[model samples]
Target: MVAPFPASFLLGLPVRGSRGERGRRPARCGPLRPPPGAQGSCSQRCGDQSGPCSCHPTCFGLASCCADIRDFCLEISPYSGSMMGGKDFVVQNLNWPNPTDSVICSFKDSIQTRGHVDASGRVHCVSPLLYESGRIPFTLSMDNGRSFPRSGTWLSVHPSKVSDSEKSQLVNETHWQYYGTPGTQGNLTLTWNTSALPSDAVTIELWGYEETGEASRGPSAAGVKPPTPAGSLEMGERRFQYDSGQQCCYTADGTQLLTADSTGGSTPDRGHDWGSPPYRVPPRVPGLSHWIYDVISFYHCCLWAPECFRYMNRRPSSDCRSYRPPRLASAFGDPHFVTFDGTNFTFNGRGEYVLLDAALTDLRVQVRTQTRTGSEGSQDRGTGLTAVAIQEANSDVVEVRLGEGAGVLQVLLNQEVLSFAEQSWMDLKGMFLSVAAGDRVSVMLTSEAGLEISLQGPFLSVAVLLPEKFLTHTRGLLGTLNNNPADDFTLRSGEVLPPSASSRELFQFGADCKGPPAGGEGGTALGRARWRPAAVFPGAVQNASSLLTYDSKFLAWGWWPWLGSATGSYAAGRATHMWNPGTWYPSFSSRVPCSVTEDPNPEL
Candidate 1:
């Protein structure tokens, strides 16, 4: 790129002082004093028709000499720097009247630091670290603490080492740190597994939406504008953005999940315990959390792990990314179940049911089921699933729901709807989370702690896949993962029921397991073998709304399917629906705008 200044700056031309002082170069433009009091208005001296400014660049704002005086009068070498600032911005012309006099450099108005006037009349100022990357304006102050103007010159600060569309140039090199663009760097240590990395040369494509870009759509040559985001998922104080079509790859932290009282929201819920199932201890591997990929929404990054690290546009094939788990369990059909121990059973009751709950580590799954309805009306043939909520340890509550439209599905991270622009898959959490639109909408967490949930549209039949570690360690309607089929009907009591238990017995067993529990939330009686809800997300309440479909006052509890607004079952399941709390202040009351059920046509 060409420099914005003329070639005379490089040669350090002897600048004029006033109209007649042509060859005279002032050491430094001292304070206005009595002689050269601030002169010249920017309106007349700052435009294209203007000529050289005799005063110093430091005198621009104070004197209002020339608007472009900083850029025009000062010559700074290497004008750009990294956002993690430390480099010096040397402005030529350190010539000061008194050798002991000091010069100060000011940035962004508030950031004023000392500028060392070097031997060559060069003002050496160190830049400060900036949270964002962009053009920063700064100014030079000649007097120690006397007076300095607000605005300064511009310095370009960049976040990434490689410029746009430039090669990373990291060849065959391993054991090195890598960072994506400013907004694209996600939790790489947790989601991406080196074992799943390609053995051959890898082609990585890093793409991210600029935080500054508006989600606007304009017509093309044919005057056709593409579709916008699918929907906006609104929790009490946070929102997640999505697109019209579900494309794949990458992940990003949503806007800070702030509560009403807090200034910045905490993202602690995304932290997971990868070690044990909390039911049965799996032999801990050193680095197991890095499953398939750890990406966010903005960056459509496919860091396909091959040999060399280079940027490319070609997409990775499905055949190359297939994963075969060592052990798996499923729940589908009229919502029949398969335990981690591979036990199969059919529970016809509705309300809410626990698919899996690991208490100690905090990984759990709960599905909301309502009475089955055919095209005619509510059918007497049992119940169907409505919503499935997956709590990744303490992190985001990802609730996959059946949309009002037949083939359409909606995903809510925390309480906000996930708007998938064009990507087919997104890693909502540390897990290699992905969603596929096909015969059914499925959310598959392909990390080492495997899990997959699919919901059939129209009918809303759900199918869930459990990892092997869940064996004998989990509790819920799906039953303990232990291989004993008879124990599948085990209640919180040590009483083991026979396989031929009556319909009434099965219903009670489901109730025992689908617990907000007996003792204060999930703390149940001894030997009560059931799944209970944990207060994973803040703002969980037992108000009638249950936050399912209530778009009203969104108070505490961001978890799905419910919390103890008053208590029904499970720590926070569908104790029913949340009562609208719009009338009351969220912080003071559990009021809601509307039932936050992601379901478009929820009954409640």
Candidate 2:
């Protein structure tokens, strides 16, 4: 039973007051996994802290609990919950203001959620959705699951099926599935029953993401059911026209496929881009990504759904495909961000900032930004990514930096600089690094580290692909990955930055995560000695254009650049702002400016 997507991608309204006080979080804590040899020798038992660390429900906040504390020490409230996963699942004993250790909830072993200490000081993540019924194996990981202890606790997924009435909302939900393993591109299969005919030169319009991993990226969330996640890639949409008897429709750009095959099943690179070529799908970003799945459909998508399926109601029994692909979280541009939980927002702060800090694994990422003074002499108003530094538990600090101009870049591993004098590839540890065509550095940290970092040319635009472990093991500017956006701005200090924070506040907030001073928890990397100034335009004059705020309705994140006009930064404006004029059939206005921001017209 899938729950509805958050309002973010919908009406483009503000989420400020929409979440209520329940969203408020107490200070956060780092992860507290058991010591290295603790899990290997320690037997399974509560109150057995004598073996290593103290084991108690209260000890969790202090990072002194046993690995299986959640098994016997801590407890969860409401043992039973709906299969849909929106209900709050709380840890009863672990008090709030947990400063040193974090709590992780494991649903069976497939899904993990980061639990937060609420205003009441209890740890929790909204309940989870389980396709199966009855007592499911549920456990806790005080150390981010280094030892899940499958022998521990349970959560009952209510067996009751959602009544058709209860599922009415799902009828209007967006249903886009990702293609699976061993396939690059595939065919777009539109299956319909024979009873209804394509009698009137019917045309099929297919809308699904082209690139691999993650969804609702780049484009405005307007007309989309769920608002687009923050920091998504900038991508365009593709359109195809099909009259009767046309074997195939030409793809807009001819690179990506909608699905691997008609039935939407995974196979070994069989069907790649079935009908035609791909269009408007951006390349995959590294570090800032993951692999979760969800569904959302806005007014534009909803209005057209009925027409597309008017005569094709039957889903073939053979089409029963089970697809649970990994989801991605990324940050790029100047730069927009899609949090681990799909929260989208733009951070234009300058200086070195921590992208995310992973617990257990000790993987830390810090990025540097440089700003350009606009024609208005707005010093440091326009910012661009300059470098990205990645450090894993045992790995060297890998820094990929932009060169002097648009076509050069430098790669440094710890203090040893890697010379790619020209376009070349070098294998480091278990990962591969290459200065590819177009002044870009691609760091594929797969197999050994679940990360892929892509730093573009000309001062660079960066993207990272996150691992599934990131869900409950990370924090920083990218926010918590618990599939809950309400706390997306949660700072490492455990403070949740409010949506109403001014530009200066936003700048300062990001600066704080540069990671505690050297010798502190997460020390800075090479070439990063002093933290960048909190203010980008230090002595520059400031006004409304630079201190923009989020809209009232859908919280479409409206951002005012440091020195430029705030014009289209408000995401809500996309609701009425017409998309590419050439993409729409039966075109209305070539481009319709939003009539009003407060109350947007669903019909463009």
Candidate 3:
């Protein structure tokens, strides 16, 4: 009846069967659809009675080419499978070589799966499906109205029947599911079981449904698993701290100059006590050495000491009178009139006086006196008179008067009096005085019984206070001196001299004295126009030379010539002997010139 199956057929070769048994026999492969306009198609034909058709060249033939007619092909309805064919059934398996067809459903990027048929006849043909949402659709194909095997579909598994092995797999993989069954259209929905999944799991998985008849296939057939849901369980948040790099600031030590806040005072008002013994002049006349005269000429003595002619007998010209005075000066005296050999001044008579011309702001005067009991009948007997007065030239009235009485000294500032008890040494600070330019300061004994006042041996000293504003923009002495040292010499506080106090001669010794004796004048005749010879006792060359050399270099470099010594003058000659302080000498020549000797016997 079967026409006697060919021997090849008995040996397991493909053979054509009757049309009625075509459903039971393996279907022959048909020609594959050609690509659009390709002008070609698969060479083999189906249902051919000729020799066995060579459809499968290799073990597994090329995958079926499903042409997507529309961009929305992936959105096909699971129930209708409308994208396939109008009959609700498509050629899922073409000439497939299998005893029973199995559906292989795979998901792309959605919850639904595309139905496929695996020709291998393995029940476990469907691969694992991944879903972002908990709801998943498992699709299958029906065979001519026959229901699929209930044991092999996702719909067949009950929650209570889930095996321990499946439960373990779900827990280890952090996956969960809710079993679902196929509807009238063979479309099933599998919902993720939230109870079985960890709280951080954003997606759920429906691993291939392992029905009773399904074969166990490894992950090689499983599709790519979907990544965890985009925004779920962020692995804790990250935080950081930033720096701006400007946290701290500092400066090197000693770089900052002293400030008023740190010094506790706004002005440089440090005071000093002359406790050291007085320096003595050598027995030989100072400036007599040859080196002294040479250095003096080298520096042009007239430029520093215009009054040098008084002792040198040099020409007195405009050059000598036009010289500028030093910024600071100390008190000096003559040997005969008022002998102040550095320590003290000896006032021998009423005619003797010590005169100083300075733009003084604050003047501090210290004096020592010894009074001898004198005859009551003498002209200066009962009252010992020692006085210090400040006045203008040719003035009848004094601006300030300080005098010694019987047991105290009275200060009369424009007739207003401040008295202090007389002691062996008196320290008087005269502040807020209005001494101005061209003012004359005289220290004298107006009347003397047998009283002797000593202004030498540090017994008499004066400290001149500069204006407070002098250092307004100056950081230190360096700034003030580098600029004009004599910039502002006006007193910060002082009373102006009244016009009535002016006279033709600003200074006079006693009531009867017309003027100072020719050589008895205790001050430089050129007044502020001449520099005050630094009071350097013959033996004080070391200290004086050091100060002079320093001031000279400062002036030469165009800096303000500031000699910090409490008592000294800047001598230009010292600039030459800078390397040797011991050999340096005063600029003045000690030997009296013939011209000076001829004029008068001058006071030393």
Candidate 4:
């Protein structure tokens, strides 16, 4: 304890002193500490220069703590600018605590402004001059006492009156007015006062004002009229006429039905009266029977001798009813003409064959002839003659073979037999042939005993097949009740009867029941009757049950009369709603209603 030591070893340690002497404390080892009067924690003062204390050595030398506070506040305060006369000035620099701190300024008892500082420490502040009152009391604060010179102070400034000229300039610079003039069409001529605007302004814009009142009310505003109901005719002012001269038939309901005339006439005629008897020309052929001749010649030359047949030289008959019309003349002359006697004939002569044209594709052939027995004194009954026509490269030929009592006429196509017949006449339809134009056709005939063959009245004809037409029958029992020819009814493709009227008798059945309600107003009632038992009991049930009652009378008169009524009622009830009315009936409301009602008060 008495040994001496270096001063460095005792620098940080407490030293012992002699009796009646004070002990000396060691010097602090860490960096210099801030003055006792410094505001805020040590870490805060060290990091933030704008804090209450700068914590710098130079600032610490100040004699008064308030001096340092004053200096810090001035350094961070926003720079001020000269104030213009008669205008409010804004001071935006005060830094306040975030979130919870606010800046409150009191210029006078009646002039106090308070606002919060943003996160960025920018103060939302404004100061107005009060020069008329001379010195004005001004006090600024962040919150509570966190402000320099935490007390009210007086600031001196003169407030001058705003001049009339200056006020006019400000009014002109701040506001704009627009003038509108009505123009042609729907356009408006708009002009604005640009004299008050600044010279540097480049563009001016116009805006339209939205209407806040109720919309206009009228029929046009309501909506467009609905479309015409389906299955109903919409003949507006147009007129139609039916030609009686033209062959036409009308249904019991007066709806005209159209048909094609088989005769060579431009006017349409009644289809049923077309093929009546006692005519020179056949119903199937209108003019010359070239098709029939060509068909006969084709068969003759292609099937038998391609060299013997020849075209017939004939003329129209004076009377069609007396003998076969000239139209029935054979393409390969009559058998007697070809055979001379009934045994032999020539072949391959010049102008001897008719040419088959390729333009004929689908063909229909009708032939009428009665078979007869051959020559007498023979035991064999004569079969129909066999005629053949063959086409050859150099010359066409015709071959005739005597039959051995075969009565049936056998038809062959390309060496293949198709059909055989023994009737007086044959009607062949849907015949497809492949003969080319300019192809030679010939004919020859044979029989067991030289039999005689004669052509019947208008016996033969040929024509091309046309496209099939689909005819729809729309006749209904109710159609017979009304037969007014003036009331026109047209059939359009794809039109179908409404379900309500499908089985029910139409109103046209009797005058007692009114026609279908005008303009679809009461049609729904009829549709409802189709399903409602109560509605059916009035008339519909009776109409439907009448047939059953009539039939039941024959079986057992009044034995089960109630059964029919019960069934009718049950059917009506079951059928109600069974069919969808929308699918069966037509709708008139094709357009949506417009919404023009204005709400006086709407939710914000």
Candidate 5:
């Protein structure tokens, strides 16, 4: 039994007990005050009572009135109300480093959720403050700081135990270090293998505390500085911008491409671990979370490949010179080999070709080219393929073919149109399409007396999937095409001629023809061409509302770009769409009243 102090105290006091021990009341002795310097005069609580109590255990305001001679005492107080002893001591503030701050692991490759990241290079923290004290007892809690259990050595965070907030936010807990006592200075080191992270995005949260000495108290819990992050992960925030025409989201600071998946009628998913079985973004229509193609002009037409040309007739005219204004096709071709979206197709010479007739204030066109190739037999029959042809007004079609042509051919139609003599054949094989608006197309090609053919390119937003290293030329091409101002291409002898004699002319059935110098007006060079579909940005919140409205003289249009909020601002520029001509320029703003510019839709 523990030692008992001298007591001038009163016992034999009567106390009350609850029915069936449901509620036990405490017994209290009459008030007893010790004189100054009296030994063991400490007034402490005794007996097991429920709810609030001071030094002495009592039920409500009534002290125990028990009349027993034995003095009952409290064995252990889980939550102590007061400090013991008459001496005062101060616990030093340890100023320890937070264990969570230094804990991080960025996976160089995608990590599968719950997949064990081998202990090699995984983040681990050992508190110097705790070790310096030799043996400081501590507890660990996986369910945050709510509860703790005794722990020695190290703590591990399995990806499976990741909470909804952590998973949704892509956060991971590699390890944490803690200090058990106050007044000790300490530091923690965290290290992780970034190559082991499951997803590209991640976040982490950590917390720790030190117990004050018997007589000391630190600052309130609210004033604590959070853990400092370690490794390559930064501590800033991220933002995004939406290009409606491209149907994709771009990082604001770096303009990096971001992938999106539609979730049909529900919110689209982001930040899911890539290694999860059959992981995918939400389907653009419903429960699906993956997309085969992102941007499809009209229906299946893609923008990543060479821009195909289609001839449209405003009216049925026997003369090819009386052509219609240009417009984009409603269909597109997928590029791959062996049923994997092949990159090549057979050419036909009989398809219709159109002329602007008059120069365009806006040079954008909506040309309808057959995006899909027909069966092998149909290719020979010219069912869905055709050649791009042109004819000059009042010129002999046959004479121009033999180099004995005479007449002023139509040149530069907005800096991209090609000039042609009546009935002359121009080879379009292996040519890259590029376009620049606001120039005289007829004059741009007038200097090339040797059958000037221009590369008229159509612009469409697309995502490049090749390895990062291979994207150099592709990225340069895109940058030059998009208002880079300093870009120019010049053709050299025999440099850009079509690959084979059969591919040289639009009509393989026609007579032999040695192609002329492959350069248009202004010395524009032709490069090899390849085609692929464009990627579209998935909606942030699906089918939010209609962004476009139409009627008579008054039309209403919204600036919603798939996943963007109604209040975002985008830089002003030309916009592209399948049903409209290439010249359409639609402007949008988040806060300003919707004011209509020239109707961007082409005359379909």
Candidate 6:
């Protein structure tokens, strides 16, 4: 008599949403063993479209129907990552539209103005019409922009275009509007004239939240209540102290506006120092980049507790440890170093490069050189194959793509590959391959593909083992990536991530920290270190899935528990590393000092 787990699988994983809706899409997870290319012979989409049986879209965006092979260890299942079964797991609040003030008419209208809200709230506004080439499609005005209530219309996948194609596809909710299309670049296109309309109504929303669960079947009947998914505490590094009372803006050569000194240097640019005089001497565009608030501040991370990976019985916490080994990270500019080209190498110029070969075989490449060919084939295919660069020149460069392949596989900056193919392999087996640090590197292999390819020494190895809570030399909390915001795991401002780079849901984010959780201003004293592959907790204890995904964009999955045959031999399930963090947590207070919290103010 045990079957009841769906309260949305105890309200946890599954929270997808990226905005920009055409079809909206978001829910997907089908084929587990049926789609490899349609497997076996012919099913012809079941409807039999002649005799080809095609279903691939990743078998429905990537199989995993959960048929059973013991569910692949369900990843050490406690509940087996269950977002209920119905799946939706809600949370959305878009609202949008923040233009701020009023007037802005230019397109020879003569630079009209009157839109302000700057003091930090940010709302600059302006619209004079500058279409030098093509792009300016602003549509939203209860009257303001002068007359624009066309209300959604831009759906043209096919109809041949001349006009009516189903319409409704406009985008540009706010930011004044200007993206290239009417005369290009200086874009300013509009011809509305209905006398505008009723004052204002530029809403434009997209919110999120859709949790629906009902399929747990056990452990107390009502279902789903194994939640201890909150924080995996322990964080450091914040350094930024400097305030002598305020009012500081250096640039006479000492450089200091947003502060960050050690002599790193950078500043100037806000109207070229506007009217100049608050300190003097401005006006230099040599390479122009000015505007340095002196950045780089993160080191706060947490939220990843799908039971924290259970270990039970005893003997495990040295900090978690077990797989990843071979360190030296911190290079790519300001910290870069991971090179080795003994047998093949070549990349004259351009940009973007990253190579970390633990060596396997067959992966050689090449580009732009027969003596630097770039003067004929239309400059050798426009500036010598600026698009790709190989396969008889012109442009095509290296590509072996896949995350699910077919499209999205790019390369350049001296392109070349010839290790006898079979896919050179760089799917990230062990770890490390981050780009953007000088970009423009090279390598080669073309003697019959260098004999099929084989070179295990220059270092590029990866076995991919990261599940013991991160196995540590210490320096806790490392989970975050929610919507990314362009930081993408380099976290430093408030840092917190003990074991969760991104389990993928596009990249979830939800987990707050303020100390032990009491009414909310807590700060300091957090004891929650977790890593349950079955259960293990020996020192410190609140790494509840890195604080529930960084404070509740919520997504701390890992719940597999359905093994009931007594001892037929597949049981191994039990991981409960909980820490909820705030609906309760005071058990007497005492010694609690793991402070540091403030990332959008825990969402206010």
TM-score for model 1?
A: 0.38
In terms of lDDT, model 6 sits at 0.20
State which candidate has the highest TM-score.
1
The 10-residue segment of model 1 with minimum total lDDT is 278-287
Q: Rank the candidates by TM-score, best first.
A: 1, 2, 6, 3, 4, 5
In terms of lDDT, the poorest run of 10 residues in model 5 is: 1-10
lDDT of each: 0.41, 0.41, 0.22, 0.23, 0.19, 0.20
Q: Write the per-residue lDDT of candidate 3 for residues 1-604, one digit (tens) a residue.
A: 0111111111111111111112453233344432233221122221111221111111012121222111101112211211111111223223333433334343322222223333343122222312111112343332421432111112111112222222222222111111121222232323333343324334322222110111112211111111232323111111211101111112355233222222211111111111000100111111111112222342343333444343233321112244433222233221122111111222222221223322222221212111233457334211122333343222212222223333333334332232222111211122112221212233321110011222332123332222233223221111122233332111112222222322211111111112222342213232212222222111111221111111123222211111211123444423322212322212212111110001011121
Candidate 4 lDDT over 1-604, as tens digits, reads 0111111111111111112112221122224334345454322132122444342222323211222333122221211111111222223323333334445555554555553344444444344322121123355554432552322323222111222222222122112111121221232332333342223343322211111111122111111111222232211121112111133345579654432221111222211121111111211111111222233333343333343223211211122144321111122322111111111121111101111111122111111111233466442221121333232222212122212243322233322232111111111111112211212111211100011122221111111111111012111111101122211111122233232331122221110111223332123442323222211111111121111111111212122122222354434322332221222111113110110111112211
TM-score for all models, in order of appearance: 0.38, 0.33, 0.17, 0.16, 0.14, 0.17
lDDT of 2: 0.41
Model 4 lDDT on a 0 to 1 scale: 0.23
Candidate 2: stretches off by over 4 Å: 1-324, 373-379, 421-423, 446-458, 513-604
Candidate 1 on 1-604: residue-level lDDT in tens? 0111111111111111111212223354443321133234322132221222223322322232343344334545445554434445566533443334455667766666676654444556666543223346676655553555323344433233212222122322221133443434444321122232223333332212112212212311111111213332111111222111211222265333322223122222111223111101111100111111112211233232332112121222122134545555666666677655566677665555566665544666777665555677756555666677776565556777666657667666655455444233443343434566533444544334555556554545554555555556666666666667767666655666677877656655553322242443234232133224322221122333232332222223433223434353332332222221211112213222222232212232
Task: Score residue 114 of candidate 6 by CA lDDT.
Answer: 36
Of candidate 6, the 10-residue stretch with the lowest lDDT total is 293-302
Query: Residue 278 of model 5: what lDDT?
Result: 13
| Tens-digit lDDT string for candidate 2 (167-241) | 212231224132222342355333333222213333332222223322333432211121223333333344322
> What are the per-model C-alpha RMSD values against the true structure?
24.1, 26.4, 53.3, 52.7, 36.3, 28.7
TM-score for candidate 6, please give it.
0.17
In model 3, which runs have C-alpha deviations exceeding 4 angstroms? 1-349, 352-354, 358-385, 391-405, 416-604
